[model samples]
Target: MPTHVVFIHGLWIHSAAWKPWQDLFEEKGYATSAPGWPGDRETVEETRANPDGLDNQGIAEICHHYADIIAGLDEKPIVVGHSFGGLIAQELLANDLVAAAVAIDPAPIKGVKVLPFAQLRSGFPVLGNPANKSRTVALTEKQFKYAFGNVLTDEESDALHAAWTIPGPGRPLFEDATANFVRNSPAAVNTHTAVRGPLLLTSGTEDHTVPESVTLAVVKLYADNTASVTDYHRYEGKGHSLTLDDGWKDVADDVLAWLAAQEL
Candidate 1:
């Protein structure tokens, strides 16, 4: 039977960003989909045109949005996500909805204590403005380079930025960063859930957005889960853009190999 693989994209990018991965996964005999976030349009151009469409969407709303889509699928899907999307994969696994989950450079969920300077700088565009909590945020090219493309060539980074970047709602970023303080609507994961299928957390050593230390803390949260499999792996010289960078195929292949082990 063909596996159902659902790809979820993080903020500041459109679902089309996952097209290459979708094609690769499909060629491997898996059914694939890259769903858009709430209020996201069909294309990146459309999303960039009206950034306001994504404003005010918090983690709760976005998580439920993907959950509803998953509820309509024919089978439990293998969820692969990047950045904020990674957090969504965890959320779905918590609900025991996915066959397996892979989170690459996932944003800090509740209880992740390692917030490095790079992570904070990458998030400054959204975090700088208190009012941004209810608005859309777009990164400048320099910021994008620093956050995602730092490991790539300047030319490659600039071209990638131009090709695939969009505005994103900042509410989720705020919700995630302050999950500990806020009791309501925190994007918290149930690390001890035994019903969850296999989960793999991948990190890039060069990733500034979600550093390796943060991923270590994320793994610790699930350390007590003996019933389900949870593993963490890292790639040297790769950044937050491992899923979208030039070496994305190599990383994807490694992911498929690991997922193959899950038999999920």
Candidate 2:
């Protein structure tokens, strides 16, 4: 089957960060699309300039936005997403909108426990400010380092932040953090459906943003969900930026290999 791989960017960074992945996927014959968020810009500088670009957006709206992009596709695309995008991929899969998916160090969806110190620390820059609930929150170099670049060298961390970081809507982080309290939360996932297709969840060993503990909980949530197959992979010494860090190609290659094994 001919597949169009739709790459989803997570919070802060816009779709531009996925260019390398898109190029590689297309080179392998998968048509690709990377859509910007509701009001995102072309570059990190542009997004940072328009810091309020993501104001008021939450999980459901963003998921539906990607759903709209998928609906316009010629085929049911394989969704590859990282960070918040990972959660979105799971949501899209739950809606039976994708052929297959790979979620790299995905933020926890509703019902997943939030006990890790690293998870809380990683989200602190935005979560610490309640005012951020209605506005955009940008990460500081130090904060970004702790959250996404702990495993990289100082130079690499700063460069990665400069190239990919932008202000993000704090509302979704707040919503995800408190999703269990909300009735019919958008963060909810339907793991019991076979139509959702095959899923592979990968976690970086040192990812504070979405620790392996969180991913493990996500896997357990699907334990009784035998209808849709789920697989797990863990990367040692990597951080939250696993998909974009120096070892990105290995991660991308593994995603392709997993899809091949699934015969997708």
* TM-score, cand. 1 vs. native: 0.98
- Please give each candidate's TM-score: 0.98, 0.97
Q: Which 10-residue window of candidate 2 scores lowest in summed lDDT?
A: 188-197
Task: Name model 2 segments beyond 4 Å from true.
Answer: none
lDDT of 1 by residue, 23-99 (tens): 99889889899989999988888889987778899888988999999999988999999999999999999888888
TM-score leader: 1
The residue pairs in collision within model 2 are: none
